[model samples]
Target: MSELKTIDARNTFCPGPLMELITYMKQASVGDTLELLSTDEGSAGDVPEWINKVGHDLISNEKIDGVWHVKVRKAK
Candidate 1:
């Protein structure tokens, strides 16, 4: 499996995590995956929705305890 760059936004809010993800996206390659760790429940829906809107690939997601582990691939 390919190792992904991770951002731990467990204490952040909805748009915070998404913004960080987008900022990081700028430096990532087309196929590179970003693993976002957030505690905001809204992120489960918000991130994926934004990912689709921005043309990224939502590869997978999981919930561990209370944190959301989301994997997004940079497409553009």
Candidate 2:
């Protein structure tokens, strides 16, 4: 069974949150799920863009209480 991991990148800006997600993604197994939490508004769009560019599965992307939650599944 695939596992879900949370990567908190709250309070950080643009590339910071995206970079953190990429780092965790590298170490994640195929089919694993990663949920990224970020206070940066750009992450709502940026994270999903990156996920698509890299050929990953985007489970969901939403904002709650001013925080962005982007969920991705490792597809490669």
Candidate 3:
């Protein structure tokens, strides 16, 4: 069974949140879902683009209460 991991990157700026997600993603198993929490508005776009570029599955991308919640599943 795949697991869901939440990476809280709130209060960080662009690339910070994305980098944190990448670091965790490298250690995650295939099919595991990663939910990234970021206060940076740019992450909502940056993360999804990276996910697509790297061939991962983007489960959801939304903003709640000024925070961007980007969920992705490891595909490799």
lDDT of each: 0.87, 0.91, 0.93
TM-score to true structure, per model: 0.88, 0.93, 0.94
Looking at model 3, residue 30 earns an lDDT score of 97
Q: Give the Cα-based TM-score of candidate 1 against the true structure.
A: 0.88
The lowest-lDDT stretch of 10 consecutive residues in candidate 3 is 7-16
What lDDT tens digits, residue by residue, belong to model 2 across residues 1-76? 7999999999866558999999999999999999999998778887898899989999999889998889999999
lDDT tens per residue, model 3, 1-76: 8999999999976559999999999999999999999998788888899999999999999999998899999999
Candidate 1 lDDT trough over 10 residues, lowest sum: 12-21
In the range 1-76, model 1's lDDT, one tens digit per residue, is: 4358999888975558888888889988888999999888888998999999989999998899999999999877
Point out the worst 10-residue segment of candidate 2 by lDDT: 8-17
Comparing 2 and 3 by lDDT, which wins?
3
Q: Give candidate 3's whole-model lDDT.
A: 0.93
Best-first order by lDDT? 3, 2, 1
> Alpha-carbon error at 18 in model 3, in Å?
0.3
lDDT of 2 at 49: 89
Output the better candidate (2/3) by TM-score: 3
Best by TM-score: 3
Indicate the residue-level lDDT of 31 in model 2. Answer: 95
